[model samples]
Target: MKPGLMMALSALMATSPAFAYEIGDSISPEVAEKLNLQPGKAAVVDFFASWCASCAKEIPEIHQFIEDDKSEKVQVLGVGVDEDLAEGKAWQKQLNITFPVYDDTDQQVVESFAPIGMPALYYIIDNKVVGKRIGAVNHIDKQIRADLKELGVEQ
Candidate 1:
């Protein structure tokens, strides 16, 4: 392959969003139950740490997306991997995050996606992951709109 083409491919691979949990992956029973409960919906699951700069930066835009979203068929879930639940709660309060957040301090839920970098993201529809933006997405609103459109969901 030409060097320039190879480099472009390399960059794309490096920035690819996620290796999300597949249908059979061992997810927490509680989370599985939640999925079972939401029969048909699109979802954005953001995994972040309290200390991660990129994660901190993404929170406000995510909140704005949730607030401005027109579709009621989607849910935004945050999984905080902070070492302590209290720390995660404090961070959420500081950020004024109102969406439901799951405390994964035990790392059990996250272990299903080992090697997933901090600020990992998953977009799901109909109980299946359709997009995973593993890192910060520039112009997140636009990206979410595109993703939702693909999932036949509008936000």
Candidate 2:
């Protein structure tokens, strides 16, 4: 290949977003309707997996974040990308989470909103996603707090 072509390819790969995702995009119409049916005033979707250690660690912070009565306005929905529903449910149980979890083993949701990493957060205000965290490693709390502020959601 020509040197210029090689350099161009390298630049494109380097500049690509961490994940193959689009923001400010609406979910599939069907999913949107299902989410709308849920009782929470605000809906935030978390894309996670049973195998990711990072996802495991963020569970408590997410629980604590939603402990207040304000959570009635804010419902946290967890989408487990695990291939097996039973395993994912077990992990959810271990986390002591009381929210509903859905299975997306086919990666339908994952493809539509490619998360940067496990425990990725998509902040949905009213019914649309307005803020997001690609990945925060061990720092999800600080970043989520900022995202909440951006959404005008008090902690």
Candidate 3:
């Protein structure tokens, strides 16, 4: 390949978005109803699979954050993408998390908000998604803090 072409390709790769998903997409209506969320507060919606290794690895950290951030400004929802509700429930119970878990077996919310991968984290404020992360990247806490700050969610 030509040097200029190679250089252009490298630049493009560098400038591309880090994650595979974005914000501002509609969540499942059923999910919204189940959570009983209004448009004023910030919420973190986690799209995950019960059998996903990365999802299992990161859930505890996320649950910790939810427990620590319980000031009514932010909350976390575990939207399981399992095909079986019973399996999802088993995983949820095994994790011992306190946050609410909503079943997304049909991929309605996953397809709309996170079509790219498992373990998607979406930060929503005022019924609008502000930031999102796809996959189980390191520094999960740092990323959440940054997104919270961007959404003006104070501790």
Candidate 4:
């Protein structure tokens, strides 16, 4: 390959995750611990950032879902991938997110998931990824509800 092409490829590779978690992929033990995922419980891991407009829009809906959820069969967790911890915390407070959120200032958590888009939702059970939704989604709460049902996590 040409030198310019090689440099471009190197840059892309440096920015991208070595591997993205997929359905049925088991999350590493360290990451599982960081998220505090329980063995039997189902969880919806949402990855977001302070600068993502789509995340700003979807977080409130997710919070609504969390409020409306009474079954407790599934837990919705947020991973704020902002480099600035203070900014990420401010965003969470602004959104009034009540569900548990992990501040990923070092980016280890988000790097482990390696979602393809700004706002990524991963459905996990027993430390394994069961489903995923990438990018900005319409009616994300509803979509999550349906996805949970499909995953046998009754609302």
* Top lDDT model: 4
lDDT of 2 by residue, 1-155 (tens): 99999999999977654344356655566566644435445567788888888888887877766664354556777888888888988888898877666678766667567775767878776456677776644656566666776777765
Candidate 3 on 1-155: residue-level lDDT in tens? 99999999999877654343356655456546765566767888887887789888888888667666756777778788898989988998898867777787766556556447778888877666678888886767667877788778886
Name the lDDT value of residue 124 in candidate 4: 96
Runs in model 4 with CA error above 4 Å?
A: 1-17
TM-score winner between 2 and 4, please give it.
Answer: 4
TM-score of candidate 2 relative to the true fold: 0.73
**Model 3 poorest ten-residue lDDT run:** 17-26
Error of 4 at 55 (Å): 0.6
**TM-score: the better of candidates 2 and 3:** 3
lDDT of 1 at 6: 100
Report lDDT (CA) for all predictions: 0.74, 0.70, 0.74, 0.89
Candidate 4 to truth, TM = 0.87
RMSD, one per candidate, in order: 9.3, 5.9, 8.4, 3.2
User: What are the clash counts of all predictions, listed in order?
Assistant: 1, 0, 0, 0
**Candidate 1's residue-wise lDDT over 1-155, tens digit each?**
99999999999977653454763344445665643425567778888888888888888888888888877887888888887889889998998888888788877657655535778877766555566777777767667778888867855
Ranking by TM-score: 4, 1, 3, 2
TM-score of 1: 0.76
